[model samples]
Target: MTGFDPDWWCDGAALRGREYLSISRDGVELARAELDPQSTDVDEYTGLDLPATVVKIEFFEVRKQLRGRGVGRWAVAALIQHYEGPWFTVAAVTAAGFWTSIGWTEARHAARPCSSTARYLFNANALPSLDHGSDL
Candidate 1:
């Protein structure tokens, strides 16, 4: 079990003054789960035997003032495009319903009982080979 950091909302000075690009127009931070490049955690989660890197997107929240403008969708799309892994996986909690509404299939249901609700895994495979300098 993992917890979302509260300081994630802090753009600068809080996170060592590091810059986090906002996926939304109002600069709301996008929650991102970065995987180990060596694929150490892939075997433990995804059933796929192949070693692959993944990034999990848990939530997409826009300010109440900026709701219903499709900004959240745009942010998620940008994140999916920016992620350059051989495979991508997400353990969507709050957004599981929304993920299913799109093309993401629920890989696991009631995967964890210790928690209050079930867990879901959504995955997508990337191209076999992508150019280093070009966008895939």
Candidate 2:
């Protein structure tokens, strides 16, 4: 699982102050993501409070043909290393497993359990984040 070598390129803080990210391996693009610091007072979808500490993930995707490989793992690991606690994202309900499997804890409460999107958080693992590919 440790073999995927990811190179990240980030630029342009124009998308609502979010930065675009691209991850590649040996010149081949493997994944893409967008990150923004949450500035709003509350989440419109779930009405959850948004604090300055939350870093919102605007987008995340791995190439279709590279789904099951370690590409996603490496990308997520890289992100955790670059950010502080805690990460926040509104994800499709179906993809909840991926978040949980990677040590993300759900932030959705019973009051908003059936919302169209689910919220998840990753707190940089107390400091170490992911250890190579094994933890990812």
Candidate 3:
């Protein structure tokens, strides 16, 4: 189960427009992602303000038992189908490859070694431009 951190999620910006979509089976929440109408800052790397019409896929996670079962893909596809917005974005660290393989392009930024987290961005309008092949 994914931990709910409303404080970390709402350190800044308005959360009223955010909608969370969950994928569950047999009473288990295997995967989930948030549909945020207002996108956060990309360049500055701070959770503040909307980045235009970008629908940010915030806080996505798939359970370990459900990994590699394609359930994650199905969940994302469902979200895409239901989403009315034109563009979507997501920021991932370890799961960047998985998202890229599903056709979400990377919004490149200078590699900052400040923390163990590796940030990646994806757009809905174009196929993902992966710097490396899918291995994760």
Candidate 4:
């Protein structure tokens, strides 16, 4: 998989509250997502004065014509890495397998759902202490 250009994601994410990102492979756009780049001085995990990055995928969709070809997984995983830590998404019940297959843990046990759909999280670097945001 082509690595995400780090220089691109953070700049756009910091410029506004949420950023629109699309994943394309072989020049064809396969997926798109809405990401919230939470840039803060204090880390949510440690409460230390350090740079912390938390990205939330408010919406994600794979092109209807191409559903199960690993595009969605790659797109999501890339965003998770590109954004760097604690990625959250509101996912449909039917898509639970896809999320879990990619190592995202269900948030019902870790955090309460604040939305109609279920929530999933991937906080690779730290011990999770989840706080669900009503907006997501």
Candidate 5:
């Protein structure tokens, strides 16, 4: 049941603020997620007012063979447990449904302008209580 862990300082000592999580198995890299602790892209893209402390899953991808094997869900869940505050991501059109299935909700902001892309938010208060190994 061993899963991924966030190598918070993967970018090295000098670039500590820019963090990335490497998901691996037996030393093989399976996936990686770029984390932005102070991302304002949510506001810039959707006009939603999110706190500066919110962790944005800026970029996430798994190897093609790893898809549908629950790796993505585990990575996200691990991140939620590792980080504090809210979580959010501007999901690509193709991946919006997956995000929703995993407990993320479409964040609606009155000021949000009409856009072709979808924005999702995982408010800490609204998160479902899930066990570490539970299927998301």
Candidate 6:
């Protein structure tokens, strides 16, 4: 898969508080991810005291044609590598397995809602301790 090039993606627009990444093949956009630094959706959903630097993935989508072709996985992995920090997103029911397959673990406080929040801690230092035995 072709990797993301920040300079190529963010060249024209001056991204202030948000960052965007797009995955494409042969000039066609296959998937996209948007990060919002100010979002507290994760904390709101999970009721956890996440650090302020933890950004939320405001939006993430893969083209229908490319759904199971590893495009989304590659895009998310690239995002984690690029940002190198804590990232979280509220995932739709169809996407929970995808997130888990990509190494994201559901938050300890997360319920098995049809749509629930999931998190990826790229930096091990940012991972919080949780009591696995506790019920959400």
Best candidate according to TM-score: 5
Q: TM per model? A: 0.51, 0.66, 0.59, 0.59, 0.68, 0.57
Error of 5 at 81 (Å): 1.3
Is candidate 1 or 2 superior in TM-score?
A: 2
69: Cα error in model 6, Å: 1.2
Which has the better lDDT: candidate 1, or candidate 3?
A: 3
Candidate 6 lDDT, tens digit per residue, 12-128? 674677777776668988877777756655443354556655656766777766678877877775565555555555444456677678766666544644443444433323435
Query: Residue 59 in candidate 4 has what lDDT?
Result: 62
What does candidate 4's lDDT look like per residue over 1-136, in tens digits? Answer: 3244343444444445878888877798787777677733222322222235546666677776778887787777667656656544444466778888877766542132344455566664552322332111
Candidate 2, residues 1-136, lDDT tens digits: the string is 3233233223333465776777777888788887776634234434344455566676677887788876776888777666654545545456778888877767755566676667776666445534465432
Q: What TM-score does structure 1 among the candidates reach?
A: 0.51
The candidate 5 region of ten consecutive residues with least summed lDDT is 1-10
What is the C-alpha lDDT profile of model 1 across 1-136, one tens digit per residue?
1123544443333332222444534344433333332333343433544455455443345544554665555555555566554454555556567656555555533344355443343443543334453332
Candidate 5 — which residues are off by over 4 angstroms? 1-17, 42-50, 128-136
True-structure lDDT of candidate 1: 0.45
Backbone clashes, each candidate: 0, 0, 1, 0, 0, 0
On TM-score, the stronger of 2 and 3 is 2
Candidate 5 TM-score over all chains jointly = 0.68
Task: Give the per-residue lDDT digits (tens) of candidate 3, residues 1-136.
Answer: 2443444345446367788666776788767666676665445334323245566777776666668988778677656656634566776756778887777655544445365554544443343522333332
After aligning candidate 6 to the native by TM-score, how far in Å is the CA of 60 from where it should be? 0.9
- Compared with the true structure, the alpha-carbon lDDT of candidate 4 equals 0.59
Model 5: residue 111 alpha-carbon error in angstroms: 2.2
Model 4 / residue 126 / CA error / Å: 7.1
True-vs-predicted CA distance for residue 39, candidate 1, Å: 7.0
